[model samples]
Target: MIVRVIESDNELQQAFNVRMEVFVLEQKVSEDIEIDELEEEATHFIGYEDMTPIAASRLRFVEEYGKLERICILKDYRGKSHGKELIEAMEATISAKGYKKAKLNAQTHAEGFYQKLGYTTVSGEFLDAGIPHVTMIKEL
Candidate 1:
């Protein structure tokens, strides 16, 4: 398994494909909302398994910290810890930039998963793109 920042258009497209399958198709999130204005400014990462892209995530430097967003693993790759790998790669990029913390709005159902990865809830449940989520943060 290999996870790294996207360095080419092909790699970026692979990340989009995974996100599209997980967020747009499976979760019913509108394409307009899932693909947002942040793409050009955010740092993107893609996870590969034996040369196949299986997961992706994005990190954006927001104000004082790094924001983790658009993290998803293809349905066929679920339960394999690829999501964890994806997030770690993003956080590594954040830490390399000298950020002291990282944050993300995690879907409620996956809060515990983020918790296990050292994130603590900072905001009560809220709606984003019609999904129940909570802000979580971790010291980098």
Candidate 2:
């Protein structure tokens, strides 16, 4: 899979489109809420398999933390660890920006996946976009 970080509006559009397919279409998240204003200010990553985009994420510095948002992998690609690769890509991008830590709001079911990637649960479970979620963090 080709894991590419967004460097232009075209790349950012690809990343956002993948997120929409996985998060808005598949998961039923409101399309209106899927695209946040932060997209213009954050660093984004796009993961592609054989030149086809499948996973994507975004990173933004928030105070002392790097916030990871819009992380998602296409259903057919879920077990292949593309999601992990995407997160690792985001980590590299954020660390290159001099961030010390990374944070994400993960669906509760995905907490274990993030945990395996060295993220620790930092916030109690809660609802986000109608799905149970929890805040997780990892020190870079």
Q: For each candidate, how many residue pairs have backbone atoms clashing (under 3 Å)?
A: 0, 0
Error of 2 at 15 (Å): 1.5
What TM-score should be assigned to candidate 1? 0.97
- State residue 44's C-alpha deviation in candidate 2, in Å: 1.0
Over 69-109, each residue of candidate 1 has an lDDT whose tens digit, in order, gives 99888888889888888888888888889999999999999
Predict model 2's lDDT versus the native. Answer: 0.88
C-alpha lDDT values of all predictions: 0.91, 0.88
Candidate 1, residue 57: lDDT: 88
lDDT of 2 by residue, 16-129 (tens): 888989999999999999997877888788888888888888888898898998888888988997888888888888889899899999999999999999999999989999
List per-candidate RMSD values in Å: 0.8, 1.0
